[model samples]
Target: MNKRTDIISDHVISALGDGSEENFKKLLNNRSGITFHKSGKYSDNTLPLGAIEEELISQRVNGNRLPEGYTRFEKLCILSISEALKGIDIDITSEDTLLVLSTTKGNIDLIENPEMHHKLDLWYSANRIASYFRTKNTPKVISNACISGVSALLYAQWHLKEGNYNHAVVVGADIISKFVVSGFESFMSLSPDICKPFDMRRDGLTLGEAAATIVLSTERKGRVGIVKGATANDANHISGPSRTGEGLYQAIKHTLDDDRQIDFISAHGTATPYNDDMESKAFKRSGLESTTVNGFKAYVGHTLGAAGIVEVIYSVWSMYENMIIKTFGYDEFGVAEKINIADRNIKKELKNVLKTASGFGGCNAAILLKKNE
Candidate 1:
């Protein structure tokens, strides 16, 4: 398949199990892992979110050290990737393997506690995760807001394509903290209830936390392959996207141009009016109106940095099962340009699929995957 340079060997997705089984089952039910955080010291007026239960996190890892106790990002990364790599055979030498992590707020949870915050730093958090697997390669961490996860994937793909490494482990994760919640609250971008993406009644986003990981290699098996990937910046605004979605449109166009038949698209769908409108416009501009579009934000809320790889996991799983999951809270179309959203479970054989992500700083990324033949 186009003389594959890099292929995804396995993907592992982790979420709180308190939600619907269908939500946790696979990619088709559109179930979100969000729940009400009654223990936090936030205002009750805040919206519900897809927060992983503390009990679940505790069950996965055991320790009281700062890296183990305060670094939620590291813990989630270790748990998620460790599960994803279960039973997979790989030869990881320092020169042949690398570990790439993407996160917007790496171990910000340490900052929540004044005592821990004073002692923790960026390198400690980044290295803690890398040391978990005893990876000898210098761990690379990308903190490019929401686009970090996809950026990590793109970096791994480039390295593999260039024959720099034989294998790479990519992990994306973030945790809910008062800092992030308050940041979104200050921006007035948080939804008070369930997020309704591309719907007439859409309001804002519900921030969530999750960890998703993927193993990439230059070997192909019965799995998905990275066909194409592109990243671009709008250079328009820092916190806001371009009105016309120039970056997103370009990213999607370039990816689709490389492969004409894109069976499904995993949309960013943050449920914010601006992001949804921009994404819908980008899809229309790319002539992807007829392609099956799916959104995982509704199911997982906006996982910030983790959303990129989290959504990719959903897209890959959809391809594995030959089914398209509907957007969870979407009911009516509100955008001026009409684009197709997978509103119901549809079983269809898919070959080429596109996963797109956008974040602050006007950054946009699109990754294409083709089903194994």
Candidate 2:
């Protein structure tokens, strides 16, 4: 029997050109994507966010040869996966390669326009991308609220360990629409400006859309490796996390206990009061209070279902560059926990890192990764 290691061969992260480098120097220097759209009915009180440059999307699609009828989510997924696999000289045979897609609302925009309602089918979205790449294996789609992206990675790890597949492509995407905007507005979760995580003035989340993809395999070469991973549910609350953050704390403890030298942590700091407070409690309970922690929501806003995978890409890239990216809008820590919130860029040699996330239904997941030598 061969021992298996969770190895990430390559990864591609898609963000608005403006939110990324080149057009903007860094996240801290760019204007927030949150804006008011007072033309629509919900616009009176709701703020709509649109970040990606249309021309950039066009360029990516043309370069990747994506189909014209593909929805925004599909196009983003195809582009990110294509880029992530570029120059990778791996032979993926039929039945050996798998594709897992994670999204909260797949093609939900099609439903808004009755003429395109039929195009919103989840199977079609999954198969279209698989067929485009000429993969004979059927793709798997997971829509587990906000944790869908991280769950996809967990599923891939299990299947690889079981020898069901040799490699897997995990992609996550979700686009903003009237449906998503209005729903969050109804819940009073949308902030009028960019989100400020762990701040006394924090209000709500700023919605953003993105697609991030990563290639995972049992083979480890020229890639970062997943050292450990664990998932748990509080079973204590239906719509919110347990006040004590029991599930999150357990997930963190499980990941760290296996390897105690985890240097950095990428927190799911959505900037929402309750979520941020619960995560702060979890960090303290896990005894990782001294570890450097940071949030990426300020840079890309909260990408709903795509947050897990997108943040994973950021964490890996930060390690690769040997720099810890700043938590753009963080100002203060309001929690009672003694946490090290990273408010400035720091250069450090990171050996192992932990990425933690929690979602609706009290679902929590934590993954540990080691930088490749």
Candidate 3:
């Protein structure tokens, strides 16, 4: 058997709140961080979004242990990574350890500060984060659109299975900026209100920003086990999912292997019309149509690069706690195909889980995790 990799620690900073405990509590109560703003940033027009309150963001950044010269994005990433590393014994400076950073846009917001925008270079941002930890190896960065987080996890999994690395610290982050907001606006995909992932009235996604970090170690034994994962692209379109859901279906199918059973699914549920429908079709083809599924987008909005990691961490928490959280904004049946979108939280002995994500470039990825027992 391949070496087993487990997530020993996780830290998520989103509109949902600071850490896993807080985020989990708010998720169960169906709290949403999305709010409407009639002024400042993005555009002068009224815009509803999922955003970390300015006060909270400032507090977290100001409290960051890292020194100054770090951008807000860097501060968020450092705070999350520091949170995950707290009380953990592994030396990040050891060569047996590696860092994998994931983000669709790192400091893209820095464009407003051209003197500092040079730091927006993803590789440079990664090195800064790594060097902050004094990690000895060149940090690996993944920028493969929205699936970047999951891809980083799988990369860590591969390294562990190769019997070379003892531990991997994976951090995914992205801050919403005028650039991203305007771009999504151009696509007409921003929700005017909190997004409803699989609801009949759902219109579009609410943009969100967050930095989430997890400590993955083959050295630790925990209930959260990284089993297997796969990625595939249907080459359907640059921005739209395949109507047949071929790529996503294949990714889920391969990840499930012969098991054909998972206690639940953490769906990509961007709430965009095509995304939700495509996922429904994919679930159907993968024979998981009846499986209970939920999306966290309504709670934290879609954190782009951080979405997959934060959702998976939430799933791990669900597995350990045996509590399935309700879909925050789901009210009515919405998808063209039949799939069980959890209308309410269900308490079940969740021994296994499946997580999925799809993004631009027609890419899709799936990951399966099981309780360590």
Candidate 1 lDDT over 229-305, as tens digits, reads 88888889999877888999888777767456888988988888898888888888888888888788877788888
Q: The CA-based lDDT of model 1 is what?
A: 0.76
Model 2 C-alpha lDDT per residue in residues 158-206, reported as the tens digit of each score? 7887888888888888877778877888878877877887776778888
Please give, for residues 1-373, the per-residue lDDT of candidate 3 as tens digits.
Answer: 4788998899998888899888888887878878787767776557877777678767866676457788778788888998898888878889989899999999898888769867879999998888888899999998889899898899888988887789999999988889999899899998888899989999999889888988888988766889999999988799999999999999987898889879999999999998999999999999998899999899888999998899999999889889889999899998979999988989999988999999999999999989987
TM-score of each: 0.91, 0.91, 0.97
As for candidate 3, its clashing pairs are none
Q: List ranges where model 3 is wrong by over 4 Å.
A: 62-64
lDDT over C-alpha atoms for residue 136 of model 1:
79
- Comparing candidate 2 with candidate 3, which one achieves the higher TM-score? 3
Task: Report the lDDT of model 2 for residue 192.
Answer: 83
**How displaced is residue 240 in candidate 1, in Å?**
1.7
lDDT of each: 0.76, 0.75, 0.88
RMSD of model 1, in Å? Answer: 2.9
User: Could you list the CA RMSD of all candidates, in the order they appear?
Assistant: 2.9, 2.6, 1.2
